[model samples]
Target: GGLVHYVTWPGSSRLLVSDPAALKHILLTNQRNFPRPRQQMSLLRKVVGANSLLATEGDTHRAARQRLNPHFRFANVSLVFPIFVETAHRLVDRWSKLIDADAAGGGAAIIDVHPELSHFTLDVIGLSGFGYDFDALASAGNPVTDAVNSLLTPLSLFVLLRSAIPALNALPLASLRKEKEARATVRGTVAKIVRKRMEQASEPVEK
Candidate 1:
C-alpha cells in the first residue's frame, strides 16, 4: 500500500511505485501482471519441489485457498475445543507428576519440557486446526505426528540444501536415501490414521 523499490540481484536496476493505490493496484488488484519475482520463487521452487500454497500463483492459489478455508474457519474450530482443553490439562497433570517425582526423590530432575509442550500443542492444533486428532500428548506422540517431528531436523536441512544446491540432489546417494526413509516413515504414519478413519466412516450406523 506504499511505495516499494525492487532491486536487481547481479545488476543495478530499480523499479518503484509512488502512489499507495498504484502499489495495491499492481500487487493485489492485478497481480498476474507481475508474477512472483524470480528471487523469491526460485528459492521456494527449489525447496519443496512442488507448487504448494505458498509457491502457487494466480488461479491455483485462489482455488486452493477456497478449498482449505473451511478448515481454518471459526465455526469448524469450535468443534475441537474439548480436545484442546483435555490435552492441555493432561499436559499440566503430566508435568505436575514429574515435579512430584523429583520432590519425592529429594533430587532436582533436569528435563527439557520443550518437547512435552510441543507435543501438547501439536495434539491440540491437529484436532482443532484440521478436524483430526493427532493425540501427540499420549504416552508417546501419535505415530503420524511423531514421525513428522522426528524428521523435521533432517527435512529442514533438505529444504536448505534444495534452496542452495538443488540440482545436485537429483543424484541417488546416501543423503537421498535418508531423506526417502524419513519421508516414508511420515507417510506411513499419516496413511495409517487416514485408512483407519476411512474404515470407521464406512461402517453402518446403528439405529
Candidate 2:
C-alpha cells in the first residue's frame, strides 16, 4: 500500500488515507491509536467543553457512550414522538402565517428559509429533547443563536494563521478576544439552563 501526502506548506505535509479499508481500520478498528489531530481538537474544545462527548476519545469516549446509550435507544425515542409532532406542527403554523401575509401583499413572495430552519432545529432540540423552550423560532435575534453562529463565522486569515500556529491564540488579538467572549456566553447560557432543569427535577410532583 502506498501513502498519499498533501503538501500544506514548504516543509509541512499532511497524510491522506485513500483506501477505504485502511481508513476504517484506522478510524474504527483501531480508533484509539488514531485520535483527532491536536489542532482540530483544540478549536473544537473551545466551542464544546473539553470533556464534551464529541471532543473525547478512547476510554473517556467509550464511557460517555455507555452512559448515554439508554436514553437514545429506539424504545426511548418512540416515547418522544408526540413532542416531535408538536414541534413540527408549530413549524408548519409559522410558515403558513408567513405565506398568508405574503399572499395579502399581492406579489410573488420570496422567502429565505435557512435561518428559520436553523431556529426550528434549535427549538426542536430544546422542546423535544430537553423539555425547555429556547424560543429560537418564536423570537428574532436570540442571544444563544447569535453566540453559536458567531462561533462558526468563516475562518478569517487571522483565525487560519492562529490555527496553524496555536501560539498566536495566546496573543491578545481582537478576533480571538471576541471568540472567547462568544464561547463564554454559550457556556454560561447552557449552564443556566442545566441548573434550572436540575432545580425543576428536585421539586415534588403533584397529583
Candidate 3:
C-alpha cells in the first residue's frame, strides 16, 4: 500500500496518512473535504475549548488563523526568542541550586528533569503567549500551575477507556468531575489574562 492506507479493527478503520504531499492536501490545500473525526474533535475540544483554532473547522478555523497570522509571522515570532533564552538560563540556575544543595548534604544529585522541563515549557508559554509570568520554575502551587497539572496528569484506566469509547463518558466518575473542574480553571485563567491585556491596550499612553 502507499503512504495512505487504511488500518482496520473489528468494528472500525482509520486512514493512516504519512505522505507529506498528501498531508498538505488534507490539512491545508483541501482541508474542507477531510473533516476531523467527531471523536477526535470531542477529545480535543475538552482540552482546548470549542472555539479554539485546534477545535474549530472550515470558516471558523480560517478566520481564527487570519486573526492570529500576523503575530505568528517569522519576524514577530523572532521577537520572543529572547524569552526562550532567558527561561532556559533560569532552568540551568535552578538545577545548579539543586546540585549544590545535594553536594552540601554529601549526596549525589539525582534530579528528575522531566517535571523541571515541563515547568520550563509552561513558563515559556505563559511569558511568550500571554505576556504573563507563571514563575513555575521558582515556585509551585499557583492556581494556573495547579490547574494545568490537573489537566495534564496521567489519565486513569477508566478515563482512558472513556476516551476510547465515548459511550463510557456518561458514567459518573470522580476523575471526570476533576477534569471538568480543571478545564474550567484553565479557561477562566486564560480569559482573565486576555481581558487584562485588552484593558491595557485600550489605556492611553503617557507622553
Q: Write the per-residue lDDT of candidate 3 for residues 83-171, one digit (tens) a residue.
A: 99999999999999999999999999998887778789989989999899988899858777777777666656665566679888676
| Alpha-carbon runs more than 4 Å astray in model 3 | 1-19, 95-117, 154-157, 160-172
Of 1 and 3, the candidate ranking higher by TM-score = 3
Give candidates' CA RMSD values in order: 6.6, 4.5, 3.8
Tens-digit lDDT track of model 2 for 12-68: 888888788998998779998888978678778878889998888899988998999
Give candidate 2's error at residue 95 in angstroms: 5.5
The models' CA-based lDDT, in order, is 0.69, 0.81, 0.85
| Order of the predicted models by lDDT, top scorer first | 3, 2, 1
Q: Write the per-residue lDDT of candidate 1 for residues 1-207, one digit (tens) a residue.
A: 455667764476776787878878877799889787564575554333446677888999889888999877788767777887888898888878888899899987666776777788777866664456766766564556555555444335455555567686687888666656666775565567678778988999999
lDDT of 2 at 32: 85
Model 1 root mean square deviation, Cα atoms? 6.6
Instruction: Check candidate 1 and list the clashing pairs.
Output: none
Ranked by TM-score from best down, the candidates are 3, 2, 1
Work out the TM-score per prediction. Answer: 0.58, 0.74, 0.76
Residue 102, model 1: Cα distance from true site in angstroms: 3.4
lDDT of 3 at 18: 78
Better of 1 and 3 by lDDT: 3
**Model 1 Cα displacement at 104 (Å)?**
3.8
